[model samples]
Target: MTDEPQRAGRRTRLYALTDGRTAAPHTVLTMDTTITAAVDAHDGLPSEWRAVLAMCPAPNGRAVAEIAARMRMRLTPMALLLGELADRGLIHHRPPLEGAETTNVHLLMRIRDNLARI
Candidate 1:
């Protein structure tokens, strides 16, 4: 039988690899963010994170969803791992592009006006 720490370590490793599907399916990873070589060299980095960094092409990096899918990990854990990497300055988490979140209020108003004109 394995010791408690060993069992916990195994669990972590398993969690790091498998997608338990507990997180929101729509959880979006910042597509524009880039992980760096520093992350690759960081000895303290978790294997799951390191795997993500390795999979990332750098400069262009990848979407959070893409990275999570590639890594076969859950969305929340992937986000947390990316946050950890950013905290360590081993990666850059670029916020979603401005104006990308424009609401449809303008469209709705235009539609309402057009309907009134009918």
Candidate 2:
């Protein structure tokens, strides 16, 4: 009555998907980083990479955490894949806003309340 088997399988799959790379190279992406597709075509790419590209269209973008959730992937592996795509000019991202830690909590609460009322 444990999920260990499933967890192991998922871990193995992620390892393969990332080609055993534990970290992204030359790129620093945070959970809130906004990702967007930079290329129109995804021919000859791996299915996971294609999935990532498909999830990210142009203009409006998705947050790294959102993409990881939608794709059922861990943040680190997703970031690694995204970093590779960015290196190849297949995608681009905007890091989380600087100084977000100092943002006004009251304003955020108001926004949350407004959203709840909608």
TM-score of each: 0.49, 0.66
lDDT of 1 at 68: 62
What would the per-residue lDDT of candidate 2 be over residues 5-117, giving only the tens digit for each residue?
12223233665756676666778888889899887645676666777777678886777877777767788877887887787778899876568753979856864674354
Clashes of each: 1, 0
Question: Which candidate should be chosen as best, given lDDT against the real structure?
Answer: 2
Best candidate (score: TM-score): 2
Residue pairs clashing in model 2 are none
**C-alpha positional error of residue 94 in candidate 2 after TM-score superposition, expressed in Å:** 0.8
* Candidate 2 residue-pair clash tally: 0
Candidate 2: which stretches are off by over 4 Å?
1-20, 98-118
